[model samples]
Target chain A: MTAPQDNPQPKLGIIAGGGALPARLASAAQTAGRAVFVIKLDGHADDPALDEYPNVSTRLGAAAKILDAMRANECRDVVLAGKVARPSFSAIRPDWRAAKLFMKVGMKALGDDGLLRLVGEELEREGFRLVGAHDILTDLAVSEGVLGAIAPDDQAISDARRGLSVARILGQADVGQGCVVQQGLVLALEAIEGTDEMVRRSAKYRREGVGGVLVKASKPQQDKRLDLPAIGLTTIEEAHLAGLRGIALLAGGTMIIDRAAVIARADALGIFVLGLGDEDGETNHGV
Target chain B: MTAPQDNPQPKLGIIAGGGALPARLASAAQTAGRAVFVIKLDGHADDPALDEYPNVSTRLGAAAKILDAMRANECRDVVLAGKVARPSFSAIRPDWRAAKLFMKVGMKALGDDGLLRLVGEELEREGFRLVGAHDILTDLAVSEGVLGAIAPDDQAISDARRGLSVARILGQADVGQGCVVQQGLVLALEAIEGTDEMVRRSAKYRREGVGGVLVKASKPQQDKRLDLPAIGLTTIEEAHLAGLRGIALLAGGTMIIDRAAVIARADALGIFVLGLGDEDGETNHGV
Candidate 1:
């Protein structure tokens, strides 16, 4: 093995899942003058943008192949990016490594966060340094304050605060990451249905007068390296279609995918995007 | 105010909401030779069966009218039956009684159970004893063990156990009443969108192999007198369409609206209807 001093900045290996975030992270690493390798998850990492990167496609359960691909490319720093859905217990045909990991966690890994933690641990134990996508794309993390031209009114802000607490409780239970609150009533919650579907369902339960606010946050015991809550232009479109007035994301904890485009769409649609203060820091009522 | 020695049982007052339970309760009370008065929730209690009952239709916020009618008809016992969606803060134009109750509970009443408790307290304070629908329709209360011809297999029973805990946590938070679990993965949770919608949403996320199980239970701190989780033909139809294998409801804590019809339909559709044992009593894992 080469001395640790031989390569202070090792090649980054990105295990790409579904969405544009993985492609963006790969680009960011290249822009930083560092070589990168991409392990595209079969049936999930279908984004054409990933084609430009040096990558190999493999099934999610093929852990041995994934580890070998990263090692062959001389990648030591690994980043798991995008959305990797929690595989149903019977659906996953785990490799030896994956089977071993599952044996350790068993049914506890059935939860989304639990499964991610197991995957993160496996990667670390294989001598690969786990890196969060946000580490490479700093600008993508939501900042504390309002985005776009629209600022939430008192009513919207109040709804957002209620939604924040509800979202946190959901996360704490490891049940969901977001919820839509309208006029102090929770309209819809994100379970396995996901955020976009939850947003769509919220439209059916909206109250009179004002629309709801979409609140997104990381779970209290979240492993940030895996599945940081994210929003993009599609989120803006869905929220608009669902008649939501604004979006509230936990500042520094949520990822704003294509921030400029998302903000521009929100501005055009007259919907506010407010970054709630860190849960560990001062309470951000958007005051 | 007649003396207690004058008459033993006063007329039963049912503040009817949506669904068949109100009408069923009305019939059950009449069959028992007890006089019944129904206060039909206008725009909500639209069941044609309710037309035969001695009733008055009033807006949800018109608590004074509802109470006055109940008093005029000498309804000393009240049962808040059927589904009442928590009204948006601005949507409710509360009368003196409702306004006072809201002022007392503040936004605490925003939750389903909280709102029911407030309504129950107001009824008690006004000298009417609150009754549960299950108390009126004794046969409707689900009993332990398999209800229909088809019994849940071990896999289905395991899914139900996982779902029961998830549903309990959701209830403890006053967020929902049910959840769908498939192959050890939570597919959907019922929030303001209600149980049928949650069941419908679960279909979209079903994994391969065995279908999911729908588990319905009263919230951990559920005010059983108000909204004990109820299911009927509609629930059966929805679950069947969603490709669910069976349903497990909290025994004695959930009301099976038209028990015979629900069972017949479940048997006809080849789906098992299992009643989990009472939460406070024996652990009924369907072993």
Candidate 2:
């Protein structure tokens, strides 16, 4: 696989997904002296921002264009960043290349994980190294320890651990990346409904029965550029509605869109935010 | 603790919750020449029909009543059988005994295993021995081999194994006893929301291009007779909508409620059903 020349700066491929993280990762990579090859999405990403990253060539591509974009730029590693409004099955418009991918891989492949894993393999077959987002930007990786003044009670800690485990299982299979746990029981798991809905649903558990722990983590063998599990100020705000005690993220694999803002919100809400360390730190769905 | 008299038949304590299982257990025990004690439930159990057992005694109380009835009955072996609606936070009417229990145990103690462990300890303290339902009705325990004519595909089996682990974790934690898995990814984790909701809500995954496998199990410390996870005709129906491929449940330990009916439904739906031999089962939440 050809590595983008050690121009003291790498050309990274950002396979942007839905959300603000893709844009953030774009700017971060550029600032760090790396050019970005962005696969700007339709519903999931704001395309107008393409003008912001000049050296970063952008394409609103179908599958062929996507692979071509990465190959043409001689990109080193790819990262999945951001959220896109996940269209129901009827909505996914797979171009011929994407369609061919589906036919080659077949419907039997697992969910998001399968889609990513297959594409990653295809990219490698054509010569592109797939790098986990966690391996890059260690400086931006979540730092371990409570990022707030308050600490979790015993129950919250237990919930957080369990939540992390469940979330990882979901991640490993590419179902979702977050879970709400309370008193050792899982309350809700995020799917297309997303994180905010899960937070609102947790309110039902609040009647002193069993409170919840919210955990978000990265999946095993996951590509970081398309959709790095992220949390921001809004996540903190949602957690407050149901009195979530602990908020957990994968130390290296996950992104906090605005770390300072998230921490500040957590501090204000008296919620505990923690970046669990790597490898074992992230829960594997044991698939 | 003192053991029961050396009679061939043992004395059984029916720590009834909200289901018909306790009465069924009592009838079974009496037929085997044993004595029975029915600890009636306040909100969950149907009080009238429990009078069938000749020596049955009833008491309406919260979680604490389970232990007390076992002690009063002078029964050496006790089975906690039946369901209690998940008490909303406001509905948690633990008496002084249960209140004391809550005050004493922390979050770790709240896990399903912990709660059952506590129940087992409390019974031991009161000189009652807690035994598995399978021990009493081993005939009812589902066998390990596939129950229906057809076996689930490899993928469904994979999903089943994954579901088993997740179900065990949730069950051991005293949360809920069922989970739906697909392609090695968890589609739903049951909590107070229960099994039915777990199935219905799985539509999102079906649309995401993956069907699911369903699993139900008893906790390691599960006491039989009360709230053993029971799946019946309705389960198969729900699985149909969610595009489930297989269903697994503990054999002897779990009740199928209407076994024949559930299996028939599964047969028609092409959903594989296996009464997994007693690795355990628990409270089924849901609509």
Candidate 3:
């Protein structure tokens, strides 16, 4: 690591969860010449790389302590990254701040996005600027066009479009953010079971000749600062295992974690990885 | 078995698929003093009890043979029962009539319900009245209110309501007909993998204290004569295995195969079996 700068940029505070994205984001921020402080959410964030940075391991529901820790480290910019399974309300032992926020939002009534927005708003109220991991790590945001050696064939493209349409419908319902479409029929829709399980289930319905496409997109009313749709090498591997022809994600709206590795895996598997633009209206007919 | 009647209400032709519903329907029809002729769809209809009735085993896509066989038995009313896997268009070796029907419907563009309706219409054109199994077996139609000994707890009732709402949205989308919801979060949505698989998958997402409810309903635009959702004893067993608290069916719109046995199984498993009415608007709110 380079010697500490005489005057560093505002420290980026990461409320890390499971998976490699949080650590990857920290590295990206550090490389961008910004000091970082990480607060790993206990039982969720388990990356050892976080130890290399100034960090504190804290349990979920300790929102007040988290705010205090970030304040102590002089972190004015906070980014929430990685997966955090929604715990049962009874399991939560929230601090005063979190409790107040929960009371205001009516914890039981809030959906995934609702809870995220409430957290973001609460953080903002304390003078912290909520930042998406993509804001600091721009390379992780999927760009326009296909990203792997294999381009989606006509059938895959059609399936991708169908998948996107279904996903949009699902998002509008605030149900889920991903789906698999095959031969113009929806094979599976991601719910609380998550994407990998959805892909696995879709495999059972795979046809002999036609392959499906997995589409992931941010919810229509989602708060981009928190819980943006994301995929990594594991997603590519899962798609391959599910006998899918390709994976399509909303361009600039989804995070492509470990972009190079994900692309490499897709290329090796001969599965296409295409970043779909929002303007691409539904034209495919079958599904 | 009773001797063949002189003029048996124009033998009810049963287009059978997998499951006990076909056999049950045959028994019900016979008990109602109507001779039954079973045209078992190959690979799907495997019930051994079919041997007890006058039956002809035939492949799907052999629409001409099916029509001829039903006519040979002097059948005027037909009931399509159980499940038929959607065959690939290339794999379908449809006779002249089915081919013409497929061409007119644009087989590639039609959804599950669309194809079913076309088939029903074509059978009507052939002077055969397509009948739902429930019409012959009145006991198979789920009655309003709880069927099993146990009643759904407040939470299960809420989850059932939520599941029904989601199922309706999925139905409107022309997707699958069932879903599992627990504590207000959708655990799984039935797609091509079917209800059993969906229930199995939902088991993975089950929380420590709360169980889910599986809701199965008919599609909004579904051809009631062709594909009404049906649950059987196996469904009750699956729900119990999946740790679900109850099973909910759309009253009057769904078929309850082997009603007594299903209720007995559910009661033994200590799970509620409730038939939901469409008019029961969302009132319970503690899923």
Question: In order, what lDDT does every prediction score?
Answer: 0.83, 0.64, 0.82
lDDT score, residue B244, model 3? Answer: 93
Worst 10 residues of 2 chain B by lDDT: B278-287
Model 1 over residues B1-287: C-alpha lDDT tens digits? 22334455778999998998899999888877777899988767868899888888998888899989999999989999988877776656788878988888677477556777778888899999998988888888889899999998877888887788777766655677788988667789888878898899899889765788999998766667887988999999999999999999988778899989899999999999998874532233111
Provide the lDDT at A125 for model 2.
77
Worst 10 residues of 3 chain B by lDDT: B278-287
lDDT by residue for model 1 over A1-287, one digit each (tens)?
22334445789999998999999998888877778899999878978999898999998888899999999999999998887777766556788988888888777576656777788888999999998888999988888888779999977887787778777766756778898987667788888777998999889888755788999998877878777999998999999999999999988778999989999999999999999875532243121
Q: What interface RMSD does each of the candidate structures achieve? A: 7.7, 8.6, 5.2
Count backbone overlaps in model 2: 36
Native contacts matched by each model: 0.47, 0.24, 0.35
Ordered from best to worst lDDT, the candidate numbers read: 1, 3, 2
DockQ, per-model, please?
A: 0.37, 0.19, 0.32
A93-147: candidate 3 lDDT, tens digit per residue: 7778778888876634444455566778889999999998889888888887998
Between candidates 1 and 3, which one is better according to DockQ?
1
lDDT of 2 at B278: 42
- Which sections of candidate 3 miss by over 4 Å? A1-9, A90-100, A103-114, A279-287, B1-9, B89-100, B103-114, B279-287
Docking quality (DockQ) of candidate 1: 0.37
